[model samples]
Target chain A: MFQWSKDHLLLLWLRLAASVCAAILLLVAGFVLLEAFEALRDIGPVRFAADASWHPASEADQGLYNLVPMLSATLFATLGAVLLAGPLGIASALFCQFYAPAWVAQLQRRIIGLLSGIPSVVYGFWGLVVLVPLIRLQAPPGPSLLAGILILAIMIVPTVALIAESSLAAVPEAYLLGANALGISRVGIIFRVAIPAARSGLLTAVILGAGRAIGETMAILMVCGNVVAVPESVFAPVRTLTANIALEMAYAMGDHRSALFVTGVVLLVMVVGLVAVTASFATETTHAESTHG
Target chain B: MARGMVQTSGVSPMTRQPRQRHARWLDGTVRAVVGLCVAAVVGVFCWIVGDLLLVGVPELSWGFLVEAPIDSGRSGGIAPILVSTLAILAVCLGVSLPLGTSAALLLSELAATDVRLVRVVRRSLDVLAGVPSIVFGLFGNAFFCVALGLGFSILSGGLTLACMVLPILIRATEEGLRSVPSDYRHAAAALGITRTRTIWKVLLPAALPGLVVGLVLGIGRAVAETAALIFTSGYVARIPTSLLDSGRSLSLHIYDLSMNVAGGEPKAYASALVLLMLLLGLISMALSISDRWLSRRMVHT
Candidate 1:
């Protein structure tokens, strides 16, 4: 197999390698699709989408998964994170891009990088120490919609700030200068001219941050206080579809286990939808800016 | 580089911004905000590493890593769990590296023609990348464990993890492959070299640093995974003598320990510190390797 001609050995090897790589992709696609389909099939095609009830020990446990509750939890946590990070993240972005000295800006960006690198589990650990203790004094314990929201919100800031900083970077110097030319106050211009221009991209950053939050698992599992009831209140401990699967999948046998797979299917569909939404906006914003720039 | 820089910096001379907005005070405001943002981020850092160090450091010892699971037979040292994590991590690399690199080569070389199969494969890779780890966990358990009768073992778990890492590797490889200059390809082609020869000698070597980056990211993910491993690896704490044995991981060890530790045991903190240290070592090593390789590559070329 070892040959003197770089052409012979390299060409032959690359060809062989590419085929294997293609095979890798095909194998993964085949396996996951098959597994997902199998899970879907067992859940029954007729009632799969409509099932709302998700009890493991009841007669109608096979009934609807009441997905609205879990969906609400996922959406609520994501939205709550955005709600917390939106104003704060944007202000931080603006501050770093236009206001800070070079050294300060670099330092800020480095901090964001370090924050993003820290594991989500650490966030959960911190939340368990500070937040769970705080929540325990007021409520019974475990897996609350509020707890998930608070933890997710805290975790989402670095993501939001990272993307938001980039969008702020993309704003042309001309807009700020042009607005200033028109006698707009610097604060007014930043609010009116720069932000409005960067609106689509900023929205992309928000959605991107939301994706990081919704996709997160470990911390949410730690603090979400995993009661499976529909979130009657934010403080009521409840399980998202993710927590439900994590809690029960290992021990459940047969149908009980299969139900856990169904929960995963739901989470997957939801995540893909979120990914698509964010991706589309991200491309659209980038495309828009490029053409105009 | 100078020309491109000048071109990007040049803008229409239409803007007469107010001197008021450009006052030195704006500089102060910007500096203050950046400082505050950096402070917030650092605050989060302090909270996590500080809390973990304070809470977890006191109980950490070699004994923690060597002990068996106890406390309702559910909590203990994570020797077996550590072994399982390494075994699965090793297995993922074994499966992913060759296949991922090969795919990267194909994408770089043959991708110019834009074949339908290539497009489909590319999209499939993207979908696979986004398919979520938990879904992979479910699939790995069902198809690998239940169907192949591998049960909950290191091999199947690693196989599933391989699938998880494949997309990341391929994507990284694509970036690496693309970063290779076309002039090198042209020179090799002009020299009557085969396409494959040029790719290996001229391209892959050039892309090695990026490949290393990709590998680091993939390894980070594989090591951190808990959900997928929970299903496919099975959470038994043991020093597995074979790949077929079900075992726990550092994260799973943490999970297993926390759930059953009766909430106040010093051992919980000890093992948590061990797991944290394990992660820190992986990250720091990956960072160092990438840095070293990047600097060497820059120097070599």
Candidate 2:
């Protein structure tokens, strides 16, 4: 009886420990909402839709807190990163899985792992030193949306390639063998049979990559010129919502502080949405796999 | 006559030769293209590492690691920053290890009985993992610093890091536990072993590689973090007297030097090289440990 009771106590301890996860989620959401409440109430949510500039001030009447430019910059940068990294990631995954010899495959895997492990700040530093100068030769001002996109693409290529490679690996050997027996060319089999089989996984990889690109802060902040205006072209300098909060939160007060929280709220919502979508896709992939099996 | 007619039909070898050649050409082109993509990725990796080594290595010396910075981090060494970084890492891992392991146990062991609870916890982890680090910085600032009255100190910074790393640690450890073969559990039960003993003796040891990998990865993330640390940790460069004292992290130092301070590039590069080398050492250690463990398991099985 005592042993059983001790086991129960241990289980209870584990349960309490596990509740920290839920507590953290609630605490983060609650605090963000509570802090952002002032801004949301005063700004009326319509201000975010207003295409005006973001000029936060301590005084109530003087400040104009519109997030349009930053929001659009964030979206445009993420889109550019996805477009650039997606094909390259998928193609690299294919090569690693299908075409590479054993040593090459092993080396590629190690490289991808190391690439992902590199700190974001390092990437930002490299961009600031090397990439910015390279771009400045072509465009006078170096730090621009193009710089941010290129850095972000490099940062997320590992994520996309890792997931893509796994999904490609999960494609059943039977499908490949059957396609080969049917006299289809190697490339035809890969494109028509293997890729189609791993379509949902590829989609998941891209979406997750997009999520990472969107949330990334330091690397982009260093590269993307933090000029709070709508970018005219890839070369035009721009600021993202994340960079805005990081730059101003140090000294913000009163309404200005609340505005930053509101920015956080918006970011939290977007990230949560992406997580939900990725979860749904994950379930769909599992369901498909179960049915296939 | 019939044989001659069949040979001249629509699917004859005369027409098939061209299509076969076309398919082969397409195959060759794709092979070359994907190979080039792979080469490009590897080349980028090499370039980044090479650049850092070439520039950062020359600045390294024994004095650089042991002395305190002299002029707003333009010269001198990173001793104080190193101490603070280690202290924060200590606090973070000290809090996260037990909590993360227990959480994984709940998910992996007790999951059979509490389906809804498991799902809720899992979803929360997913959301938390996806939340941006800058947002976490804001949350940490509000909750730990302002509300909890920890202020901008190592305690708050470490706690914030703990929260940020929990999801990764839990998921990785849970995966490790799940991958342990069920036969061990059945055999333990058959031998009349208690549940606690089975967990402590059989399960955790088997899952050590996963736990190690998770810990190393968490360390990597925590060490690399700049945005999340800046607000909670503050930018005080002094060696922290206690957990309540504010201190500077290496990543933050690197950032401030490069961006805010003029003529601080060389110091910044040196600091970055130190950080990079530290991370590389941890990763290689983890790889070797996991490799040895895995090989031992294979041999025994």
lDDT of 1 by residue, A112-219 (tens): 555555556656656766778788788766447777887787677777787787877777777777776675554556667778878877887787677667667777
True contacts kept of 2: 0.55
lDDT of 1 at A195: 81
In terms of docking quality, model 2 is medium
lDDT of 1 by residue, B1-301 (tens): 0000111122234653466436435745755765575566567667766777887887666776677656532445656667788999999899888878877776767786646646666766755666656677877887789889999999989988988888878887788778677888887778877666666678878887778878877887787777677789887777888999987777776665555456633555565566555666655655566657666758867
Model 1 / residue B255 / CA error / Å = 1.0
Q: Write the per-residue lDDT of candidate 2 for residues A1-293, one digit (tens) a residue.
A: 12587678778888888898768999998998899998888777888778367888735565888899999999999999999899889987897888877667767877887888888888899999999999999996999999999999999999899999898888888888787777677887888988998998898888889988988899898999899988999999899988998899999887779889998998898888887887898889889889977
Model 2 / residue B53 / CA error / Å: 0.2
Go through the candidates in order and give each one's C-alpha lDDT: 0.69, 0.87
> Candidate 2 — which residues are off by over 4 angstroms?
A58-60, B1-16, B288-301
DockQ of candidate 2 compared with the true complex: 0.51
